[model samples]
Target: MAKILIILDERTLYLYQNNQVVRSFPVAIGKASTPTPTGNFSIINKLKNPYNKALGTRWMQFTHRMHGIHGNNQPSSIGKAISNGCVRMYNKDAEFLYDRVSIGTPVEIRQNRRTDSKNKSGYSYYTVKTGDTLYQIAKKFNTTVEKIIAINPNIKNKNTIYPGQQIKIPD
Candidate 1:
């Protein structure tokens, strides 16, 4: 299996195969104060032509919706620090990574130390919209309401989602 390394501190991503670095790309991490989260993760899911909601003043519980490594609908944003939290890549590059990765592949995200989290997995961030429900979002993503609730432990109840809530979708 191919290994992917995301170094948030260096603002670079490396894809490795058979023990050699196959490709590398520059990334725009969260601002200095808002450092990108560091941990071992996996691609739990995939999406295409993803739409991103800009980060605003509000504490978006459902912010980062439309967040995933997907084909860019707006190709112009590549190599820019534009996404609220999601990793934005060029359309062709994202598509290439998507094709090479699977649901259970391991992903290591590090800022200071290396990660050891194994098992292929993925995640997504969704912003709640008007008249939205956990169940509806789950169905749309082919996931379950319980799963969504599990990922976002802060949510007290499935029925309490408000518009502009940023929920994490786990695979």
Candidate 2:
């Protein structure tokens, strides 16, 4: 059996077959303000090239009829938190996934906090988005950039961050 697992925090979609992950694809998820619901779900409807170009070439409606995993017209948005509660993938990736999965396939969406074996301070995680800056994030969370670095020792260059990159934020 094939199954889908979406880890919102990591912005990844995993394809599983026979209990093993066969493939993984980066995906864009709902923004922080409109986070994707976390729960067990199943693919319900599959549509190819729907009327909306924003949906790209494939649309798989799951537990929530309004929210589906679909192809994205904005390629750069993939792997970022920019969707309106839907999972967005590269057009080709969506097509690839669409060809393999069927309606009613089990889909599980959840958020997992990343923890490095060396450090586990339980700080909040934020997925970097387009035009995001370390200073901006620090200000948004009302913390100092130095504090963020203290919690996330892995961030060597506070000057550089790409969209979809996950970083820890102090609470």
Candidate 3:
């Protein structure tokens, strides 16, 4: 079974299975002015690197939002509070999750209050798809393969991404 976790505190999301981490990526959360609606959400639909311009939403700094993780052909300030409320990921990460998780997968978005985990590493989850690997996912997330393994003790090797597999990403 596929399990999805949306961490509102850290502004990250995770996908897991059998206690194994699958995939993770950086996400843009809602602004302080407008908070992301909390509750369980299902994968209502899927889009491959959707366009914000098509939605009539202007980019923060770029001419357009392209690429994975909500990037557009136009360059813009990405690493900050910009999105209205939707969680924005790299075009690649979003595309990956869009393909792996089905329309009915439960997406739990909640406030995170655990402030004292001994392991303060920023953890994220990535869902595997065809032609995915630890190296590719890590590079796409601006992370490393070793860090990915560190977060996920279950993945013994780097070349192990079967569709639906969840890999943990460590920061």
Candidate 4:
């Protein structure tokens, strides 16, 4: 079975086979009041044409009770935080995922609070680690330190970054 990693902040679901990302799709997450649960889970159920208008053409239920990755009638909401508590996908994307993943496929939903750096423009976030320098981080992210600093004005000292400090990585 394949592995699924869903990043809530990134609004993305990554399908992994052999530890490599095979597919990725933008997804809509839960609203602020009913945030998506985070943890390792498994696809416990799969249903085609779930018969619910809100659920759309497919449903891939996870271990989280009443919370699954499903298709939505509102295709425009695919990358927003507007669902009740489930992950919402386009019908075609949902069908594609349903066909590729099995009932026992592992699923991981995570909210990276430390680096809650995702934005509407498809930017990502990264956290500073011990022994990590701006030069190294820039190279790792394929960006430059100047760009990083320009976006993050709160960073007073470019040379000194504490562990766990969240920084923006521009697209």
Each model's lDDT: 0.57, 0.82, 0.54, 0.81
Ranking by lDDT: 2, 4, 1, 3
Q: How close is candidate 2 to the true structure, as a TM-score?
A: 0.66
Which scores greater on TM-score, model 3 or model 4? 4
State TM-scores per candidate: 0.49, 0.66, 0.49, 0.65
Looking at model 2, residue 67 earns an lDDT score of 87
For candidate 1, write residues 1-171 as lDDT tens digits.
777777654556778787677888765544433334444466665544433423211111112343334444555665565555555555567656766777656666554222223225566465565567788778866789888887788887887898656667664
Per-residue CA lDDT of model 2 for 24-65, tens digit only, reads: 999999886666755568999999999999999999998554
Point out where model 2 deviates above 4 Å.
113-171
Residue by residue across 44-72, what tens digits does model 3's lDDT show?
Answer: 54444236453222221111222112333
RMSD of 3: 15.7
- Cα RMSDs, all models: 11.1, 8.3, 15.7, 11.0
Best by lDDT: 2
